[model samples]
Target: MTFSIIGRCQESGQLGIAISSSSIAVGARCPWVRAGVGAVATQNVTLPALGPQILDLLETKQFDPQSALDHALGANDYSEYRQVTVIDTNGRTAFFSGKEALGIYTAVAGEQCVAAGNMLAGTHVIEAMVPAFQNTQGSLADRLLAAMHAAMTAGGEAGPVHSAALKIAGDPIWPIVDLRVDWADDDPIGQLDSLWQAYRPQMQDYVTRALNPTAAPSYGVPGNE
Candidate 1:
């Protein structure tokens, strides 16, 4: 069981997804985002391939979120077992929760943001994330993480979530933020947020190292020093 939020930042045009699940290594399966394309989260029965496939439709195939979702799910024999959500460059969102989605499933679509979950505690689990994503201050990563925390407070999955991930795509060829707590017997969501906190201040430095090594800052580690 999993719950996730996908959002596009209005000011930066960045896309991000924050997700947590009862399953192990959930990050390795769900939550995909491309810098200039879009974001997608495929859960429920969890066909991991659908993440990249839907992103392809949004990028090269000239498909909107809704069309891409329709085309992707339409082709799958087990489509009814999937719960997928999509958001594109234009801030449009599309979400589908198949009939066979796990217990107490629901979704919420908000401005430039959307969230969905299967085996959630209730619809409020999805509903609470919307306003948190909308009103939270800071970067897109910050807001996405905030929404994730809100989901837990609102009553998360029908069961305790053991794994979590949050990813954000900026202008770089690589992800600006990709943090995961693959499996935590305790609170994976909190651990994921703590990672974001540790990573945020250094995010730009990593990009600088990649794009222009000479201009990058010191690593502040033993060998690097």
Candidate 2:
């Protein structure tokens, strides 16, 4: 079982997803985002392909978030067994929870964001996340992490979550930030937060290195002396 949020930042046009689950390597299968297209979090008997499939519907077919989610998941006979959330570049949102969703599933949609979960401790997990994202001030990444933390505070899934992920699709062809704790017996969300902090300062440098290596930040190697 899993919980996730798909969000679109109005200020910078960034699309992102923050997710956690009892399953290992949840990042490899659940969260998906394309810089100029959208984001999808497919979990609860996740069909990993569905993540990109939803994004493809949004990109290639020019479908809005709702239309893309409808077209993509509706076609799958197993759709009812899954839970998903979507947010497109335009800040539109969509979500679905299958009839067969695990224990105590919940979904909450807010301005520019949508949160969903199955096998959750309570609906409050999703409820806590939406407002956390809406109320937090800072970059999209900041709000996303805040939402994930709040979900845990409100009591996450019915069981312990072993993995967590944060992914953001900014102006580049690649994800600007994609951090994950594939498996952590301890606090995966907190570990993910630490990774984000460590990576934040280098975010722009990585982009610059890709587009203009000469202008990228110093590596801080011994040669720098």
Candidate 3:
């Protein structure tokens, strides 16, 4: 019912996740990133806690992606129903897809990234995502969105994906980008793309507003008038 990619930008040292699913509010459950730590995507019969837990391991415990994933998966009684992907700050990646993960499951790992899907149209859904992310020339967020677009073009989930999310973490304590289409009967990916386009230019403005409101640009809203 879901497919996702977790990746790091080698040049900028940012981490992010792009995900979509037949389920609603997939953003709230599947993707997690810690600034200067790592990124995680927990899907299939998702254990949302696993996402943060893996990041905590990578950050606080100094565990590599594989070690963090192994520690987390080992403790779970229902590991077979879960699918997870992890990438550490150093771009080391690891992934696991349990035998019980529902229909057409696969996980593909590439330099600085991992893509995973379950209940997909085919393995190509994830296969297409990796190269798209690796080859796309842009910011980490742009590459992530491109990967999602590629996945959708490759046939996407076996059923309609109602929710989609893009989350990226840079140097800030909060995410540099966090966009979501909680539910849409059609094209959540397109909606997310539009959101990204609107956000890109203003992203630095948002950070500036947080750190120095007086120097920040105008709110540009009706209420400001």
Candidate 4:
């Protein structure tokens, strides 16, 4: 029902998440992230509580990626129907794919990133996402968008995706950039990437307004943080 990519940016110290799903309103059900904490993708049977619970664990420094995931998985009975990936603030990453998950899914961790997805066409789908993000250079949001594009090009979910979203959180407030194509035509991934790119400048402008109000354009100036 869903395919997601969750990770933290090594350079900006920001966290980014992207997801696409054949089910309507995918963003509402999957993909959760918090800056200065960690990121999580909960799918399959879906455990929404794990999203904030994992972030709380990371925030208190009570556990690392592996242990936090272990603790969360240990406390849940539906572990077999769950898929979760975590990338902590320090860049440490880990993930678990339930044995009962649909189709094929794998979570891969590298020096600075983690990539995970299910119901993909093949193993290369997730494999291509991370390397593509690593090989590409720019903002963390751009890299995440690239990863999503790579997965889609490699054959995303077994069926057409109805919804897609990208979330990046950092200092000051909730999220620095958040965009969602809750429902789209046949090409949700491509449309998601386009929305991300269009929103980048606005994000920068908003940040600028936060830090230096005079520098922001009258209309571009964002509200009080």
Note each model's CA RMSD in angstroms. Answer: 1.4, 2.1, 1.4, 2.4
- Residue pairs of candidate 2 with colliding backbone atoms: none
Q: Write the per-residue lDDT of candidate 4 for residues 1-225, one digit (tens) a residue.
A: 676777677667898788888777778867778868888878877888888887778888989988888888888788999988888888888888989988887777765677777787887888888887888888887888888888888987777788888888887557888788889877887888888777776787778877898897566336634
Q: Evaluate all candidate structures by whole-model CA lDDT and list the values in order.
A: 0.91, 0.91, 0.93, 0.81
**Cα shift from native, residue 63, model 4 (Å):** 0.4
List ranges where model 4 is wrong by over 4 Å: 208-216, 220-225
Q: How many clashing pairs per prediction, in order?
A: 0, 0, 0, 0
Model 3 lDDT per residue over 1-225, tens place: 999999999999999999999999999999999999999999999999898888888987568889999999897789999999999888999999999999999999998999999999999989999999999999999999999999999999999999999999999989999999999999999999999999999999988988988878886797642
TM-score, cand. 4 vs. native: 0.91
* Model 2 superposed RMSD (Cα): 2.1
> Model 2, 85: alpha-carbon shift in Å?
0.9
* Tens-digit per-residue lDDT, 57-87, candidate 1: 9887578899999999887779989999999
Q: Of models 2 and 3, which has the larger lDDT?
A: 3
Better structure of 2 and 3 per TM-score: 3
Query: What TM-score would every model get versus the actual structure?
Result: 0.97, 0.96, 0.97, 0.91
